[model samples]
Target chain A: MDERERSEMETRARLVAAYDAMSPSAEVTDRVLARLRDDARVPEKKRKSVEPDSRSALRFGLFLLPLAACVVAAAILLRPSAMMPTATKVSQEEVVVEETVDAASSDAAVAGDASVEVAEEAEGLAPQATKSEAAEADAAAGAESREPLCELYPIVVTPEGRELRVGDVYAGKFDDVRPEESVAFSEDGKRSVACELIERDGALFVRYGDSADWRFAS
Target chain B: MAIDLEAVFRRHFATVYRLCYSYLGSASDAEDAAQSVFLKLLNHPREFADSEHEKAWLIVCASNHCKDELKSARRTRVVSMGERLDASLGATDHLDETIDAVLKLPPKYKDCVYLYYYEGYKTAEVADMLGIPASTVRNRLRKARALLKDSLGGS
Candidate 1:
């Protein structure tokens, strides 16, 4: 090799040696595993489906509580006309769901199933859980827009149109926030955000959440 | 793909930590960045075609995370703990000068040069690993060499 080439080789050798001299803390593996265990506590996943059993439904119901009002208001606003598009969105999500299933299940997945099992064991022993501690299975793997929060909670509207599951909305603060159903509501600007849609008196008002203040738009 | 975390971490941790150190210039920050990369993998698990794809995913993820960290408001650049340890352990006198030069290269060139030269991957392999064109990798490597040579006393 010429002088230029020799110098390049020398530089490469020195840099490589410098890099080799370095190593991570011995506890890196333990640190990472520990962090995963901690995050699994919040359990950032939705069930594969709303199970037929009451226990699963009740467990899942806790997450869906926040979305009830927003969904109902949307349903009222968008019944016969909005039906077609919502159906289309579901189909699109179905396609995403299919893709993610093959990718996630067929490919080696990570850290969630064991977590779920641990959660189930906890659930059996405890009989009750604080919402954050509740272990939930994650699905809708590929779609960024999908909210695992459910259809989880009670949005049951009485015949007189009162008590629309006010409070306790828990749409997660995802890194990539793709709002599922955006109303004219813009509390802190989350699209299709989790909010309480209250029918107070005769007029309706919206309460935006799993964070931010109550926003009212009649 | 069966994700054995211990296996994957053992395989990729050095590379990830090195890349992070190169970017952040601090061993503690590099370790933090490296852990975040693995945590992301655990959180958003994806199917890789093979080990190559897995490595590529990690390089990209680590690069992105480092860039974000650099851009964040709270970012503080500290001296490399590894560099200090290397000196304390009595690396050759020129080692620090060479490292400082390597660190001076732009981030893109730094990655290409490190993978191409230090990591000892061929140009085409570096291209594949970086998801960039071989020509682009070659170009970066060429530019990196010129830059290195300029500092290290060669044409």
Candidate 2:
């Protein structure tokens, strides 16, 4: 053989020699086969007091319950803030109404004799007075409530024409909102409102016409 | 019904364990990896189409499992100068050094060398096993031979 052929032959011989040398010890295969045989035998089914089918079904249901709860928690956690109803706004409205009614009734009770004449003559006037007084009370309550709203100030109108409301306590993409803007909204194929920008606490806020509080333009 | 796992084990255990031993250089690890290969076979026996398919699957699975264990252990098989000289004495002793050198090569080249030399697989078989083109396997083998020749002093 030529030198090149000789070199090729030597290389092949070396590889073959190496392969033959490294063949696993007989004990390795014996151990593995032994383990395999040991693993193959099915364990005897114990005579269970419980029905196997029902037990398995119950176990499966138990397993799925946590998974379902996790899925629900994840859904609740990952759910869009826009889809969740704003409890803050609803609660704020309720508080405002409660305060106004309480103040009106207290004033009516304190004005005992005056309230009797007022109740008689103002039976006609009573309704108008109550309506005007309620309106005035609401305006005053709204102004007083403005301080807390301005202090934290959750809602913001973005430059992208989307209203960004705080969905949770912390400031992020997802936070709950209490609406500070009270613009007339059209409920068509889309519910939308437009409000101008107002600044409070070094942040740009949104203000609908005649609204007492300023919302953040997020 | 389950396939005859014992018959499969009896037939392929030696080849599978030898392939793992070549890769890992430890009888214990080879046994462990080989057992894992059979356990995998037991769990998913329907994967094989025929006897030839089963053999090829065992070799590939054994090789892959050994590599994964080696990676997890953060162990690289580095043959020392003394070890290399010791390996050159006998074909079987030198085999670990050859494999260690092969493993030191890049993954593509290492696999080609292992499949071609240790498993006695044809280049086409190696290509099919690795899911690469046959030409790629040939090129890798050529590069691996050149590398091994250089490392083993051009012998």
Candidate 3:
């Protein structure tokens, strides 16, 4: 054998002796056996093989129960024709005929009038805003346009006419305000955003969120 | 089937512990690993084709467990300085230096070197036990020798 082969053999011999020297104590063996003995005494249940069950289907149905209810409620609340008086209904027949006659002359104007009626019906606003309140709103909207663009806050309105909440993004115009920047509405502007529009005294204002107040431009 | 737990422990404990100690480079960790291996056998029994199969299984399991332990964040946080191999085996002064050098090897090579050199296993046998290709085991052994030669410095 060459010198390198002999040296390799010597190195192997030394490693073997060193590793063989390290052995576990008797206590470890005893402890392991004791653990096994203790475990053996404990009763173990028979393991069941996995199989598909109807319980999962039942659980899935139960999970969807609330979602299904929400969908149905949304359908009823969001039906477009439900907001208008039913023409065929016995109670609203006369009102519907009157509305039909009025709609024929100014169908476009009726939409704006319908908003006033809804606000009144919902008790969200005072009755017809009187004549003085209407003047104030017009003054507010007029004064808002004269103000510098920076003074005005972007109010994003959905095509559906509902005012969107703060931080909600929609790609469309709300009156004169165009979709260019993200909209963030606020009331007090200190804690959290409140409403999109606010009426204090006779003046109407749009909250730009975070202590920013501007006249209602739309 | 009732296999004698005590007999198995007595016969194989030293081999298992030595394999763990060589892999881990720490006496405490070796003992813990060896105990865990036996507990695994206790909890889950398997039919061994022969005594060779049983020994090979234990070695593979112990090596795999130590490798996993070394991978843990805790092991990395605490660097392992080599512990004194038990003196009861009556190792000479030269043997101690060799063992320390082996322990200092990178983990990738250390286990293979230990199984091949210390356990008196052929390269093929070590490969089979480690679930690795024989060519890979030979490569590790060769790399380990070069590292050991450099570390030992003309020893």
Candidate 4:
């Protein structure tokens, strides 16, 4: 090789020597391996409970048959039929759904006063005058009581814009509600809607079949 | 037989680290890039035809990863000024001058030069690792050598 070629070759050798010397510290390897070990220890996929066999599935279905029938019956009874007239009808009954603010406000005009409206509405289909009297008495006591009254409307409604029947169990969230003040409404023998309000969580949450993680209104 | 990851890591970590260090001027970024390449191996252990293929696979992985890293906004914001030479190696003026000149070359030429000279990869091998044409790799090396020679005062 010529003089310049030899010099260039020597320069390339030196550059390689410099780069070959550059490697990370040993600690990086140790840390990486330790992380990998931890990863290997834990399962990559979630462990699922064993699935039931066909016979078990059949048995479970059979067990739930009666309950399923009851739910079906309830749904049939609660189905909004143009031919069916609601048992409890007040001069003005509004349906309030929390998510729809416009519906809540419009319904608020009809179902506004808990004492007057609930009693008046209950009197129409309530089995006994005494039942209405007792509910009215409760309303009167609340009329004088210094506790905050929260008007709860079923979040779910029939397509015909009606509230759930008194005996129907509601499964949903409540916003700005006390569980205790919360009531699961049922109809009296007179077919009038009435609430069986129970105190829960310092009268904060109304117990509906079971407590759920409720997503409150933002 | 299954591939031994520990042996692979031991054998190729320095080359991978240096490749990344060349692409990304920062030592820390190079370390991260090297570790990430190894992590990818852990996640999906690929089978190679032979030791040469395994080494080529690593070089390709490291080269592609560093190319992506350089394209990122983080790399743009934090440009590593120069090579972080090993303290022992930096003591020699000639080695330091040559390395500094090589690092100063544009990324395209710098990569070609490193693979060609430092890693002892032929022009075609460098092209294969970089996913470029052999002619392009030769051109880059030619341009890089000319630049280095000019910068090093005919040496």
The TM-scores that each candidate's chain B achieves against the reference are 0.83, 0.74, 0.86, 0.84
Error of 4 at A123 (Å): 82
Candidate 4 Cα errors over 4 Å, as ranges: A25-218, B1-3, B77-83, B86-90
Task: Give per-residue CA lDDT, model 2, range A49-79, as digits (tens).
Answer: 2224875776578778899999987885676
- Model 4 accuracy (lDDT, Cα): 0.58
DockQ each: 0.19, 0.26, 0.32, 0.23
Ranking by lDDT: 3, 1, 4, 2
Q: Please state the error at residue A130 of candidate 1 in Å.
A: 78
lDDT per model, in order? Answer: 0.58, 0.57, 0.60, 0.58
Measured by DockQ, the strongest candidate is 3
Q: Please give, for residues A1-218, the per-residue lDDT of candidate 1 as tens digits.
A: 89777766776777787676555555654675565455544444632221237646654675686689779888867877456674464455345434444454433235444333433333232222222222121222223423432232234333444433324232323222223322233333333344444444354445332222333442
TM-score result, candidate 4: 0.48
TM value for model 1: 0.47
- Of 1 and 2, the candidate ahead on lDDT is 1
* lDDT (C-alpha) at residue A166 in model 1: 29
Q: How many angstroms is residue B65 displaced in model 3 relative to the true structure, after the best TM-score fit?
A: 0.6
Tell the DockQ for candidate 3.
Answer: 0.32
Q: Native-contact recovery for every candidate?
A: 0.40, 0.53, 0.69, 0.53
User: For candidate 1, lDDT tens digit of each residue in B19-129?
Assistant: 887777766677778877877786677778888788888988998898887775446545654643433436564765666667667788878877777667898888887
Q: Model 4: how far is B56 from its true place, Å?
A: 1.0
Which is superior by DockQ, 2 or 3? 3
